[model samples]
Target: MVVLAVIIGLIFWVTSDDSGKNTANSTDLSGTPSYALPSAYSDPSASASGVPGVSGGSSGGGGGNAAAPGESPAPGEPGIPGGTPAGETPQPVPASGLCPDQNISVVLYTDKPAYVEGEQPIFTIAVTNAGLSECTRDVGKAMQSVTVLNLAGDRRIWASGDCAPVEGVNNQLLKPGQQVKDTIDWSGTTSTPGCETVRQPVAPGAYQAVARIGEKASAPITFNVNRPAAQ
Candidate 1:
């Protein structure tokens, strides 16, 4: 009976060891397949020189194409390592032309050159709007006063009374493409009565007529007064 018990115990031990070995083999086969994994697929031999997928180590990491020597960078990528992208540079703005709407201009004129001493000479000044748009009453009325000054001879043209002038002061208005004519009469007595018979020549000199439009002064138009021969 003792020998038979020993033999039975030995058989049970051998069966138990074989069963554990079979369970371990089955688990290894059911687990993850190492051959199909990404690590095994990465061509470690791709690192030679210009190999496509060699630069960036793993797929999840950034691409390693740090702009080749002088070549331009890829789209959406920065030029230098730690610098700004291509689109960050500023762009130039377009220019618009000057005073396109106003199209404003000025002109000046005078009457006969010779006049009798003490006789008021009549001069005509005409203001016209050459622009396509109507010059409102405001500008037409703002023409303050037009005065003539004798730049040469002893005679002087006075604004007080010698000249009857209608200036476009505040509230003056001119219509578009319209012209308004105004007359200025100059009458002043000369020191020499004899000067009148000889056509008292207003000495040769420079004269300027300016128009005040809005708050700005229009460029002055220059003219000259001719002096008559001495009587």
Candidate 2:
């Protein structure tokens, strides 16, 4: 009888142990009964769609970094300056807007057609813009000069540049039909290049005056220099 009772007690204990373990495992994994979980936790797709911007939807209907409207792209990016694309070179702006020579007309002028020996002669350089647009040039004393050539126009006698030259940068913009004039006085003395030779007073005779600016020379103009007694 004792053996029989021991067998029954062992079977009952095993059955109760199995039942308790099954109940604990099922209830623990079934989830918290006191707190409710979000729908995203149950449905995997809800996690992607419920949160904003997490989805693969972006500008152009695709997933990539897109600049917002009215926002400029960062520099050094593709298609930005400094990394300019081929055949799209940026044009450089010039400091001096110089005009073409064909558009500029350099006309020479003298204060008078006659002067007395030992008298100072005045020469005027008139530069006019003959083009339809505005342009620039350096008309400073550094680029201007006057020369008195023999009637033959082959020999150069006196020149404004023979002495100390005027200096400065006088860049000027000229409009169509606009004219600028500059004046220089002649000492009526002959001088060599670089003022290397002692200058001598020129002889009384008919002389030609020519004005120059940069590489442009004026047409020779006729003028006379006579002895002071004849004036």
Best by lDDT: 2
Regions of model 1 farther than 4 Å from truth = 1-104, 139-142, 152-157, 160-175, 189-231
Q: Tens digits of per-residue lDDT for model 1 on 19-104?
A: 99999999998895767444545465666343675564445655766697989987784556666433222122113212122443
Q: Write one digit per residue (lDDT tens) for candidate 2, span 52-163.
A: 5576443476544556899875555466468653432222224466866666677787888898889988888998776767888788999998888888889989888877
What's every prediction's RMSD, in angstroms?
A: 20.6, 19.8
Using all chains and alpha carbons, the TM-scores for the candidates as numbered come to: 0.33, 0.57
Which 10 consecutive residues of model 2 have the lowest summed lDDT? 85-94
C-alpha local distance difference test of each model: 0.48, 0.80
lDDT of 1 at 172: 31
